[model samples]
Target: MQNHTIYIRTLKRAEHTVFCVEDGQKTYYDPQFKRMLPYASGQQVKRSLLDSFCDAGNIKISPTTFYWDFNKKKELKEGEAFGTCDPTYPDQLIGGWMKASKGGGSRTLKRRSPLSVSAMKPLHPLLAGVNKDSASFDRSGHSHNKIIVRGEDGKELNEDEINTILEGKDRSLTRKWIPASNKATGLFIQDIAIDLRRLFSIRLDDFEPEISQEVEEKLRESGWVEGENVFGRCLIAPVKLREKLIPILAYAIINWKITSNQARTFSLMETLAVSIGGNANKIAGAIRAKLSEENSEQAIPVVEEQVKGIDTFVTPTAAGYVATTTESIEAMDDAEEKLIEILSSYAYEALPEFAL
Candidate 1:
């Protein structure tokens, strides 16, 4: 019942990454800002978090629970129903869900997500722009003009013989010339990216009434008593639920991945600086101050400075600073343990009821 509204701010640095696309180009034009900004939409950020949470095994909920639409008449095993199918389903507390009527009626089932993700924006105005690069599809060392066809007799057919056999056939034989390797060189690409060590901001806010009355009624009908089950009580108490979800969000951001043309080969970002807090401006101010320092060597120091005299939580180690997945996971584990210890110190009445 305490003020459940919580605002989380983070500053992250990524390089050579494009967060969105338009007209086959990896950039977005922000009309409000009247400029081309390196940006990621809210939907993009939320989807990444949901996917990361599911992939990392941090949350028990399936990705489909919050995203998939289900047929009411279709047979579903236990826990197979989409979160929207049952309001009381625990995962619905995350992204929420909506299902439209199948018969083309006006009826619909929907729940507003308690979590709000802001479109990621540059912390410094100078951080927004495009980076020019090129990608190649090189097949130079191999033959570019050979077209070997297998005949029905299991023998290779020469181009002349194949053409002669299909002399009058218009449907079966088709041929096109392949450009020489020199002429088929790759083209340049423009990506909206941050190449410098610049800071960017993203805000995640959790607000009041985390669960709807309809959902509460459904939970009661299912024999769920408030304060009995950790899940149930957490759902009813927005602050507690927010605390439980903090680690998952932290993991997602630290292990942040996005849609990029070159993601398959390697991560686009080389290094990152991150901090989390309930006040967006304060966190940004602290980050700016730290970055302005002449002798600062690392980004984690920003977190340390920001958390002073504030209800902010700094990940014990900067998972974002690690180079490999194993290191990232280890760092996150350390962070989660530290967070639990911090929560324990507050002596929240519900602290012992659940393992956040």
Candidate 2:
């Protein structure tokens, strides 16, 4: 098993101590810090001050933070900083930071690569802004040059900004490569074409009669017609007709074009809405609030008017029939069914397949 070390910072210390969790307990050991105070178990500390003890992963200043030599390491002083030397990379290596042309700016850039020492040519014209590509003379006489960089918006950049871009920490402009999985990419072309043909069948049902006739005529004119099966019909359709069908199918799915079940569900929801003062949200909330009470008999008349025919019972009094409480098993079951239809419609409408 691999052991992970946790680094923690103290309020007064400049350096952090390392610790690890073992057997559900955390422990630390550091000679310097231990000289003042020693480590303890969780039971020894109070719960109120536990947050301070568990605080870790904070960055701090120290000479050991950077590499001072090939093998030796040292921390930077309070006022000190570290950076790459004059010859930042290998002499033969191409592409790195270089100074800009005269009068362009005092700062360096990482735009263009250095030229070979043998194939000598004058870069004066380029420096004069002929093609926006030029080279700067290095004091070390090395054949390496810096690449000029621009900001994310493609605007001109300064040295500091260009260096940040070269560091490649920001990946906003980078395209992530997704590897093809066996289950998806391994499908045969013929199989995929068949599935797409079935999908096209589902899509084509939404087209208007006139539009479908027009598409059929166009397909026949282009030497294409409906095949024996959906997949065959899909294969038979011309590219132009296929293109025409896409938007129509997309529109139908997006707007949820009047299916029988959807129409019935909408009617039921509308009926409920009208019965309970024409606001579903307010009515649902009111129903829930009223049902939560110990004796909700009084709230029955208002709710029953909405749910009676759809999900509850209608009681007939001496004068006329009236809707009463919806607390009964039959009424509850009916409400549940209606509510399911309403919720399913909402959920289906919110799906990406129905999105415009």
| C-alpha TM-score for every candidate | 0.52, 0.14
Q: Which ranges of candidate 2 are over 4 A from the true structure?
A: 1-195, 199-219, 225-235, 257-356
Model 1 C-alpha RMSD to native: 12.0
Where is model 1 poorest over a 10-residue stretch in terms of lDDT? Answer: 194-203
lDDT of 2: 0.24
| lDDT value, residue 331 of candidate 2 | 32
lDDT tens readout by residue for model 2, 250-271:
2211111111121111211001
lDDT of each: 0.43, 0.24
In order, how many clashes per candidate? 0, 12
Candidate 2, run of 10 with poorest lDDT: 184-193
Give per-residue lDDT, candidate 1, residue 117: 66
Give the runs in model 1 whose Cα sits over 4 Å from its true position. 1-3, 20-26, 29-35, 58-91, 100-107, 144-218, 221-223, 226-250, 259-265, 268-271, 288-308, 311-356
- TM-score for candidate 1, please give it: 0.52
